[model samples]
Target: MPALPTAALQLAGFLMAHAFWTASDLPPGGHYQPQSLCMRADGNRVLNSFDGTNPKEQDEAARAFVTGGAAQWPDCAIARQVKVGTPTGDVDALVIDVVQYGGSVMTVVQAFRPADKGFRLLGDELMLGDNGPLPPLPAAQAAAAMREGALDHPGMDGKWNQWETERDPVSPLVER
Candidate 1:
């Protein structure tokens, strides 16, 4: 086993960790599962799974990422007591759940807005997996697949069986 790529970016200029409130916390939709980062990406709604089983869900997701989607949306915000992870912090370990549709092999999404000061739409912050046409796996399996290249092991399970497969939509889509 090796240190997750997140550790490599502790001092990364792009690092924007909010905080760690809890483990196994679920996001808005049933699809986006809870992890270290509550991000603005497609599978974020897919519950961390880059699956396209539900087109309606994914469509809303795709537009969101391309058009400054979710990050711009504002709901009556609730503060989560997140333990912001840092390279020099007391937290010995870190895990950034990468989830993007058409970017790197590490599952990351691009988060930004049209104007530097305007609100972004939550829908525009999400994009489903790209690169190769693929299917969705259960949430647990999705997390495992994300760890493939970056880990000594990169494997996932199907509905009820362990599976070995290639990971794509691994990185976040780069904006122009």
Candidate 2:
């Protein structure tokens, strides 16, 4: 979509503004302790979807999404669509999985759902750590689950972090 570039800019600006990599909530050793940064998307829709089986467009989107200082770091993110098993229907959800090393290996997952023209953040962003009992693609799985219907969406699957409630946490928290 024409707004793909705008989406990229929004994402990059969002990430840069948030500085999730240096999050104070991360446990030491970069271990996998599944955690979530609970937030509600304010209906800030992105006017495009990286909805192809091939990851070329998704990869580029991921690269563009993670920009500024985070961009300086190596590519620690992937873009892909997860076919979600939903009650209403099967929906292909756009997900970006990012692994950042601050004090811990934090895998950040952002899931988006089909809006009018493009997509919007499903509900909230999820983060899982280095050593956890989750599937290898915990981020993807979590993102897909986000689109499974608007019930009790697990922002972090019971591993709620105090950081989520912080006033100055992140964006897309605004509900439509």
Candidate 3:
């Protein structure tokens, strides 16, 4: 069997951890549901949702959501921030490196947009190698690659199964 990259392992760990965390942290009167990760056209931000009700609030909420999830892993820390050009425009991303566990440097990339309150989390990626600056591919191309990769890999399916099984059994919210 081939060994998975450190970043891939870290991403899988994050998904598993997130499943458990979200299951326990369901919103008041809301069912437990995991949000889909999304990247903006500019590639500067990714989000679970942006209903446009309140951009600032939404951004802050996303940041808190990511921060809380990342905090669960004591070994992970922000490595650096970089700006990448996208089809829409340039965006900033945070590179988080997880050390002390797998013995290899694992990096997760997160992008954020500035809000009135502060910076809000936009999205993240699990980088496997020295892929240079993230948002490495253009937004559309990156999204397509992600879709293709998820569809092509049985590992992704296994990860989803693990996420579902390890999570608490509660009704999930209907996606809009």
Candidate 4:
């Protein structure tokens, strides 16, 4: 078995040891379900930043970590926040209430990230959340969403092919 990264282990610990049970609450065929985009940590500590209201350039959270925050190691944004409620619990566990703007309405997507699984969007394991939790995922799902987006990480074409070889059913969110 692959040695789970410490981050992944911690994340799993957070979910299994700390997180609580919650429902998907989404209406049938709802597009605003929670999303999480978990990438693998290459070396040391994993790094991350959210897209928030802007999709241009990496956000400030990333800058802080990239500028040598805690772990002076290679970092990747493996986890995302999806609020299920007002954040509660100690550092060990938290429930976040997911929020996303749709036609100017901020819809709440109750979601959470699990430690064992990559991401949870509600029904299946997820890789990326649309806005964070309620829906967790495997990384492949997030890749699909990115492909369906207007633009994508240029040098990652080869990466997607590699993922396809490993996982199937890429989400339509990805572009061609």
TM-scores for the candidates: 0.18, 0.29, 0.29, 0.22
Model 2 segments beyond 4 Å from truth?
A: 1-75, 100-104, 115-118, 131-176
Q: Give a tens-digit lDDT track for model 2, residues 1-176.
A: 01112222223223322222223233432211111121113433222233434545544554444442233333233334345555555543333444332122344344333333232334455445555423446544543343232122224342223223332333232234
> What tens digits encode model 1's per-residue C-alpha lDDT throughout 12-62?
111212211121132422222122222332312111222246634454444
The candidate maximizing lDDT is: 3
Pitting candidate 3 against candidate 4, the one with the higher TM-score is 3
Colliding residue pairs in candidate 2: 30-104, 30-105, 31-130, 31-131, 32-129, 32-130, 32-131, 42-174
Off by more than 4 A, model 4? 6-8, 12-59, 62-67, 70-79, 82-121, 127-176
Weakest 10 consecutive residues of candidate 3 by summed lDDT = 167-176
In lDDT terms, how accurate is model 4?
0.27
CA-only RMSD, every prediction: 18.7, 17.0, 15.0, 16.3
Q: RMSD of model 1, in Å?
A: 18.7
* RMSD of model 4 against the true structure: 16.3
Under the 3 Å rule for N, CA and C atoms, how many clashes does model 3 have? Answer: 2
Q: Write the per-residue lDDT of candidate 4 for residues 1-176, one digit (tens) a residue.
A: 22213333233222221122212223332212112222234433222333444422223343333223424322122222332333343111122211111111011211333324433333213332344322333333332332332023333434433433443343222223
Separate clash counts for every candidate: 40, 8, 2, 41
Write down the lDDT of every candidate, Cα atoms only. Answer: 0.25, 0.34, 0.37, 0.27
Window of ten residues with lowest summed lDDT in model 2: 31-40
**Which pairs of residues collide in candidate 3?**
46-122, 46-123
